[model samples]
Target: MGIIDFFVNLLKDPRGFIAGWIVALGPIWVYTPLFLIVFVETGLVFFPFLPGDSLLFAAGVFSADGGGLNLWATLIVFYLAAVLGNTSNYWIARLFGSRIIDSGKVKALTPERMAKLDHFFERYGGLTIVITRFMPFFRTFAPFIAGTGHMNFAKFTFFNVIGGVTWVSLFVLVGYFFGGVPFVQEHFEVIVLGIVAVSVAPAFIGVIKAAMNGRKGKGGE
Candidate 1:
């Protein structure tokens, strides 16, 4: 498939795409892209749109009985990918986040999103790291924002490990257990979309709430 088609397939049908990879790449080599996707999605703030949640769920499905992948291996690879990815993003931000944010180059880091992240940090404190792990766009940006001096390395790592393990385990095991149901097998694409929607709902809600608050402030003035 062409590059566009490749991503299109990945986005549209993560389960089918992953199953194809297991067949084509075999059990061992398939972990490379799995690792890379999770890594890049978490590590690179610009790639927040990547399918982190759905991909994990899909991998979990494939790791089921008679499925090609080993459950333990999948879990380990994802755990490492998630933790290391956040660590990489944290350092990148600690070193260059201000410059990157000021450069006006990353269109994804919008004013509203930044404000939302700030709200999370202020409201949740260091626990924001663990909380946002299940949130798609926020998860990608949380470490970067934390690394901008809102949090120190030691504290960040504590929540990072907790968040990574919890997030990966939850989605993967859910998929492993439920992916074979008749409804899920019949409507896998729909399920993937549902996962993406549920994962992104909080970020959308935060944006709406922020917009509303901005309006209220203007009215009070």
Candidate 2:
């Protein structure tokens, strides 16, 4: 329960957590936690719900404050985490996608979602990785689906690198530049929430579309 509360706080106020950690543990230790969170969020399917965008934004805010954390180091770490996380997910799907799907043990890899992901890959090809980088659940699932679909590794790598860097840069820079504005700083949590909402909105739309298609199929039956 305490662990659960900690993560909830993290999602709700990443800035608070990062700030506190920097104060208590000093700057050097903050990177490891950030790295782990980003890696888990992007690498593991079950952890897509973790606060990737917000965390990066908060880290950027901290970096902007000049609180011992080097901005370049933070960006480099984030970029590596994002890329490696997706790489891990891709290899996992490539190796065990069928077995995992058949076993039904993992809730995130449901047949319906996998089918939709496959369709998304078919429609978008390697570009799905790039596009989904800004999307919530899809960002985590894209690499996995591409692996299962046997997308050319070279093509996947190209788009993955671009998406990873762009996604991190956009959120982090926004925080670094505008996060200190009194309005934003005062309503920091609100802004973070808004960022998160915008990030996941596309996935919600896709879910709505899928539901409509499902209903249409039933009606036709």
**Can you give the TM-score per candidate against the true fold?**
0.96, 0.93
Tens digits of per-residue lDDT for model 1, 1-221: 78667766798888777888888999799999999999998898878888899999999999899889899999999999999999999999999999999998889899888888898899999899999998988899999999998999999999999999999999999999998899999998899999999999988888888889999999999
Off by over 4 Å in 2: none
Candidate topping lDDT? 1
What overall lDDT, based on C-alpha atoms, would model 1 receive against the true structure? 0.92
RMSD of 2: 1.5
Tens-place lDDT digits, model 2, residues 106-208 = 6866567677778778788787898888988778888888878758788889999999999999988887888778998899899999988988887788788
Q: Candidate 2: lDDT of 140?
A: 87
Evaluate residue 56 in candidate 2 and report its C-alpha lDDT on the 0 to 100 scale: 91
Worst 10 residues of 1 by lDDT: 1-10
Off by over 4 Å in 1: 1-5
Which pairs clash in the backbone of model 1? none
lDDT of each candidate versus the true structure? 0.92, 0.84
